[model samples]
Target chain A: MDKFLCGIDLGGTKINTVIITNKGEMVSSYTLPTLAHEGPEKVIQRMKETVYKVLEDAKLDVSDLEGIGVASPGPLDAKKGIVLNPPNLPGWIDITLAKILEDEFKIPVKLQNDANCAALAEYYFGAGNRTKNFVYITISTGIGGGAIIDGKLYDGANSNAAEFGHASINFDGEKCQCGSYGCFEMYASGTALANFAAKEIEKGRESVIKDIAKDGKITAKDVFEAYKMGDNLAKELIEREAFYLGVGIANIIMNYNPEVIALGGGVANGFDILYPIMIKTVEERCYKASFEGCKIVKAKLGQNSGAIGAAVLNIVFSKN
Target chain B: MDKFLCGIDLGGTKINTVIITNKGEMVSSYTLPTLAHEGPEKVIQRMKETVYKVLEDAKLDVSDLEGIGVASPGPLDAKKGIVLNPPNLPGWIDITLAKILEDEFKIPVKLQNDANCAALAEYYFGAGNRTKNFVYITISTGIGGGAIIDGKLYDGANSNAAEFGHASINFDGEKCQCGSYGCFEMYASGTALANFAAKEIEKGRESVIKDIAKDGKITAKDVFEAYKMGDNLAKELIEREAFYLGVGIANIIMNYNPEVIALGGGVANGFDILYPIMIKTVEERCYKASFEGCKIVKAKLGQNSGAIGAAVLNIVFSKN
Candidate 1:
């Protein structure tokens, strides 16, 4: 029997399930709206349905699968396979996701933080494949990170090693959701870009952004659009954001000196626009030797990276 | 026959040599003035004499040693065992101290940056002994750091990983020697503290520090002393320095989430005076979970940590 593994990427708005061969080639996939407003039980049922649908699409029996892996936003207890109350997903306090999935599927289940899954994906298939030591940073609504040292994930003493977003760029600057002031995320995340655009618009700056958002609800996409349209305010905001992001990256480079830094998530879709600026800023800030020859590249797996990486967790932890 | 190892710690003011048993127990140690003004050859000879004297003090012959390890300031090539233009040791550029020592001692020689040696010492015998992942930061005249991940030193791609001092805390802040602005070291190092004090004095701040150093030469020691005497200016300066240090530390804690953070060097000697303020600032800035149970302790090895750690290099590399 061809052994297969299942992976589920559970997000705030959706759940994606995929079944793959041992070699990591996906055989079938399924997706479902999370409807998290209905709560954990309903979400879990939807996840199960997606899993069953994926397996059915592959014409595979449950008995043919080796195990299941799940990737989700964290503060999660990965050892116990429980999801703690993540900021993005409310009312999810102390949910035993792994146990519930295991009980339903009668298969061993592994759970890891979503950012960690992305790092694993990068290590196994993305830019990180070229180096044993690297960091994967996903810049979306918020910045998230994972570290791969010696070709393995580095979970710190509390299983929360790479919280790169929370790293302070200014100790006495703006307040952050984590109750800190001047965290990198506060100044450089997609949310920060949106906030910057909104603030600029409110300051009476004339731009195409105001036309795109009649209700004054600015988004990162709108900022990028205005930037493309040659709005100076939008351009300046992105440049500033890239500068902060670059400083944060330089800090990471100095501290970890990873051979590669793989960038993922929605914001990285702007890599072409931001790469040169980020590179210039980072090069100017970090040690010359440490920055030399270090590869900074966009993540190749895109949205599927989490699911693909989650499936590979079985192989990774099994060895350990 | 029982094996022996030799370690040489090359410093700006002095050279320390120690003979140790294979088990890392120190058998004998000696120190000599670096006489850096006499140039590399003379200092190298003094280092050789100290090594031979220490071995003789231990009643051991040179042939009984397994290897020799030397720890020196970097901007050098460790793989080539060369000391390249270390700022403190003027006129010592591209000097192959390792090769010379190896030729003289007829044994294999290993070289490492002194900061890395301190980290290795901490990892093997000091505060980091129990933690597989930690960062060792030395806040002296300059800030330097080493990272120990999974029980091994992380040298990064160019053996320059863990340049913790270079990590930026503010993009437009003070300019550092490495040509960047707002580096952690620029705001947090002992030298930085003194610089802040000097700048304040120049600005006509009223303080007892003026009485202690009417000659216009200020040191971090003077600031600490003034703070002890309840000098408000000194207290404020120290508090501000501590705040920067704490923020830098919080940045590390959030980004790396190490199991422990070991503080070392002469500046760490004032840990008693600095600890509370630093901890308070970190508490205000860091994520709760990242710092919740993380241990921050003063390095236990004191001044000899570099030599001892260098001596242990054979064991660490061999075992790995």
Candidate 2:
């Protein structure tokens, strides 16, 4: 059938809506702040407004579309289409997100976690390119990942599978917020890089990281900026970040043995600088077969990946 | 479809052969010493002898069987039906074990790694019992595992996907034989447990572990024997073993998110003793969503698991 698909990427800070043809061509898209501090009801209302706006911009009515897909922060049940309490979205306790949207739009709605959506998006339209076994890892404030196994996204026993960040690299190193010890995120996430720099600075190690950070706490961005200016501390921290990232990647290689590992999120901005050392480190740690079979690349889809992935959910699931 | 199945479990020390019904009832079985030092050609000859013996014992000819399955130590190509150089099997380099068997028996034959075979056996006839997503972990001298995903055995990119032993738990800890730093096997294998005990004893924390071992090297068995005698050092070493095993298991849970994790091999013989501490540590390290969903249980098939798994390979893969 010739029709459009609607998608909503419901993030902590922004609500993005898009309308795309069945083949994934963009028709209309809209974005607005989530204003999460205002709570759930208003956020839900604004999400509806964006959907209507996208439909109007595309010059089509609801009858012209198949259904809507919502990608949200998880701990949510993709099967039940309920939003459990996600730390990112306050007051979303067991909310029937898909049902609400289905009732409001009078069409079917599907929901999935944001990370899985990005993975599905990359597999279909970006770096992954339909590889039967593909993994997408995002390394921003925290690390997150999704595995597309046998050409479909794996959601695990719960909707919370592929929590790669929580997998420990140091079992006795430090306690993590998730009640685990020495999580991969604790050693390799962008937040970890920044935190390491801050602690070293607090101990009075002199570096331009402080000057770039100004009066605020040192951020990974500040460290990256310092690395551009020949700051020794920044160089050291980034090198360690690359090494740590390689360790985490090797672990993923051991587990999934995927054909491609597409990197995304903020820290991946330094992909060029990180590639050489990161590849060397992964080579040292992983087996020859899995490592040789896998390609480590940067993700192709940009900021709109979530929207594209959500839109494709109905398409992919219908095919499944 | 009603024909019997034949299985051969080829190991470092012994070769076990079995004939079973398609539904998994054992008909006849036999075991013979492998004498691996006698090299590949002789080992292959002996393996054929045992298969004939088992068939004779069951009063059935090869023509009466559906197919034969060979389970061997890996680093081999299961798809190609070739046995590569496994450290445990001397002088075996790209030997076409399956082709040889197929020619000898004039029947279809399947070859899979030992760990994967055990996982298949468990999923079909034992503890796993048709669980869609299941993992089988065997912690012996070394740790090895196999995964069953979506009700099918997951043969990853190179048939080496579930090499969990090599996934590091300590990035800066010990260098493993696989050339990776701080592998889970280095910290938690039964060999590791005994090595940890031996090191502590060498530093002179007096215990009956030394007495139990006599002139022999301190082994995981010796440690358990001393634990039975209320030896403090043995107790401490076992406690550490439980903790490290838990850490490795938590990592598996993070990656696979399977519904069941069946523990097998020598270390699992002490499952009752290790259960309390191991469960506590896993609970402490893993996320509740997965932890609550998974059951860590002892394998049901005992030593015959290998033979049973190999026997069922044709039954399972034929359906796939």
Candidate 3:
């Protein structure tokens, strides 16, 4: 009987479930809206249904499954497999997701932060493959990151390491939601770009974003679209955002000196505009010797990175 | 026969040598002026002499010695054991210190950056003992740092990881010597304090620093002394410096989430004045859960940390 595994990538708005063979070949996968307003129990019930659905579609019995993994937004305890008050997920206090799933499926279950899962996915199958040490950063609605050191996830003293987005790049720049000032996410994340465009438009700055927004509420996509059309304000805002992103990357280089830095997420994927300037700034700012020959590249895995990484967690730990 | 080890801490102004038993008992130690103006060849010769002297004083011979370790200021390659243009060691470029010493003594040699040595020493014998992960920061003329992850030193791809002082906290604040803007060292280091005071005096501001500095050039020590006497300007300056220090510490917590953060060096030792304010700022900025139970304490080992750590390098690697 060939063994199979399951992975769940859980977020506030959605849940992704995947079933794969032990060798990492995907058998089946599915996505579902979380309906978080219905509370943790309901969401968890939906997750169980998704897992069963994936297993059934792959024509695999529950007995063929070896383990399960979950990638969750966290400030949670990975060891205890508990979800504790992540900012993205509301009404989830101390839910022990791992134990619940383990009991439900009668198999081992592992829990890791979403950023860490993304990093692990990159390390094994994406841009950071074969690198002993690397930093994986995701620049979506908010910035999230993880570090792989010596080929293993670095779960800091309290299992809350690699909070890269919260590392303040400007101590006096602006108040952040995380209680810090000028966090990289506040200046360079997709939400940050949208927020900046909205604020500027509210202040009566002339720009095409007003037309793109339709209802006068700008989005990061609108800003990018405006930049593509040669809007002067959009160009300036993006330049400023790129400068801060570069600073954040430079800071990571100085602090971690990882073998590779793989950038992913929606904002980073605006490569035609952001990648060139961000790379140039990093080269100009980081130590010459350290940056020389160091690889700074786009992440290879797309939306599936989180689910695949989550699934691989059991494989990695079993090998260890 | 019992084995012995030798450690050399080489700096711009001085050289410290020590001989210890395999079990880490100090047998003999000595310090001498570096005489760096004599060039690398001469300095290497002096280092050889110092090692021999320590062995002789400890009543040991070449047959009893296991290996030697040297900790030096970096920009050097630890893997290659070469010194490559450290800022403090002017005119010394691409000096193969480890190979030369190993060839001379016919024993293995290990080379590490001074800050890393300090972190290693602290890991085994100081504040970070028994802590699986920690960050060691030195706040002297400039900031320096190293990290110990999973009970081993984390030397990134180029062996330049944990250049904490160079991590920028302000992207557009001020230009740094390393061609970056607003480095943490530029805001929180002792040199930064002295420079700030000098600039204020140059601006013709009213301050007791003018009286404290007979030569019209203020030092960090001079500012501290004036603050003790209740000078308003000194108080304001110290407050600003403490705020930046707190910001740096907060950033470290967010980025690494280490179990402990050990602070050392001249500026950090002035704890009676800086600790309260610095702690307050850090608590106000960092994620409350991550900071909980995390020890932010003074480094246990003093000036000898570098020498001791260097000697422990070979022992650590040999065991591995």
Candidate 3 regions with alpha-carbon error over 4 angstroms = B204-217
Q: Over the stretch B80-178, how does candidate 2's per-residue lDDT look in tens digits? A: 899989999989999999999898889999999898999989999999998989999989989888899888888678788788999999999878999
* lDDT of candidate 3 over B167-257, digit per residue (tens): 8999887789998888999999999998988888788878888899867777788899899989888998999888889999998888888
User: Taking the tens digit of each residue's C-alpha lDDT, what string does model 2 give over A170-268?
Assistant: 998899999999999998899999999999999998899998896778888899999999999999999999999999999999988889999988888
Compared with the true structure, the alpha-carbon lDDT of candidate 3 equals 0.87
Which model scores highest in DockQ? 2
Clashes of each: 0, 0, 0
How high is the lDDT of residue B43 in model 3? 88
Candidate 1 segments whose C-alpha is farther than 4 A from its true place:
none
- In CAPRI terms, where does candidate 2 land? medium
lDDT of 3 by residue, A1-320 (tens): 66887889998789999987766677999999988888899999999998999988998877887788899988889888999988777789999999999899998999999989889888888899859998999999899888999998887866677788999998887898888888989988999999988888889999998999967778788888999999999998898878778989998898889989998888867766887788888887788876884788889887877887888888878876
RMSD over all Cα atoms, model 3: 1.8
- Assess the local accuracy of residue A235 in candidate 2 as a C-alpha lDDT between 0 and 100: 93
TM-score, cand. 2: 0.97
TM-score per prediction, in order, is 0.96, 0.97, 0.96
